[model samples]
Target: MQLIAHRGLVRSAPENTLAAFADALSCGFHGLETDVRLSADGEAVLFHDRTVATGVPVAAVTRAELSHLAGYIVPTLAEALDAFPEAFWNIEVKAPAAVAAVQTELKPRIERQRLLLTSLRHDIMLSMAEALEADTGFIVWHRPAALNSLLYAAMPHAHLRTLVWYYESIDLTLLQQANALGFRNYVFGAQTDHEHRLCEEFALHGLITDHPEFVGLTVTPPLQ
Candidate 1:
């Protein structure tokens, strides 16, 4: 199973910062996943939330200006690519428009093979899939909801892949369902023997957790 460091090995460093990504690389995590949002000033910054008390969106500030913020400076997508040239990037674009901006920045520096473009928005995913060629893969971040809803519209398509970001428990049936469809599975810190059993049963493509060292490591039983 591929181990993807959620938020760039968040255990060692601040989440989604250059420091976190560097730590993930040093520790040998092959793929790094992070969220992107636009700052008020039109700069694309690496951040997860919609807004903070400062009343400013991440995109509003440039990397240089955001460096002084106490929370964490919103980094441009470009900065991340520069920081880790060889790493596989799982970038979740918060807004559909961000995809175009990201592509514009990424195209000149590296080829599309190293990146996986993804979004929860089906329209955005479709737009990106349409804009880019077949080689550039698009993944859909999945959530639990009514099966017939608008969000699940992309699940039936072959090109659309599913990435589970968060979960309270490991439901083997769900993982099996995902596997049956040939979609990749991701779980957050299922660092236990039981979870491993589920992972093994489903043949997960990848696992995400704050602790990278425990990945693929056997989870020993607790004291009786």
Candidate 2:
């Protein structure tokens, strides 16, 4: 199983910042998962919330304005790709407006195989899959919805390539079902040591966690 850094090793640095991403990679995380939103100018920026710390809507302000308000400039999607050219990316489009911009920025620079585009909005995920060859995954925050997604992905004709579930929503039954169906399962918010162990025991395809080191250390067992 791969250990993915959620928001780029957020436990080590500010979430979605370059510093966090660098820390994750340096510590040997297999991939990076981040949230993307469009600035006022339509640039794709790394951010998790619709608003900044001061409650300014990111879409309503230019990246520069948002940066000023936050005291540090947020990394752009392009910047992240440039800085970490070898890293696998799981880019989550946080809003419909960001879909096109994220695709445009990534299409030319990265290969489809190295990326996984996901979102809570099914329409946006489908649109991105149509626009790019990269794999598409769904982010399910609720248990019932997650079960539905799992069942759907089991269909031979289903286009879903991955299932990203909220960590708390997953259980042994769901894991077994996903494994039985051959769907690549990933979980987010894996913050505890026990959760990391569960990921290994289940052989999940990946885990999204703020503390990558905790999981990264166990990605490969010590050589005998």
Question: Which candidate ranks first by TM-score, i.e. highest?
Answer: 2
User: Which stretches of candidate 2 lie above 4 Å from their native place?
Assistant: 110-113, 145-159, 216-224
TM agreement with the true structure for every prediction: 0.75, 0.87
Weakest 10 consecutive residues of candidate 1 by summed lDDT: 133-142
Q: Write the per-residue lDDT of candidate 2 for residues 1-224, one digit (tens) a residue.
A: 77788887666578889988888887788889999999999889998999988888999998888788777778899998888888889989999999889888978865533788889886787777667766788887777646655455325334466879898787778777776776688988777888788778877888888765566452322246
lDDT of 1 by residue, 107-224 (tens): 6654544676666665776666556542222342444553235225556455556555454644566666666666666665566666655655667676666665456432223246
lDDT of 2 at 106: 74
lDDT of 1: 0.64
Q: Model-by-model lDDT, in order?
A: 0.64, 0.79
Candidate number with greatest lDDT: 2
Model 1: runs farther than 4 Å from truth? Answer: 53-55, 71-73, 108-113, 134-152, 155-158, 189-197, 216-224
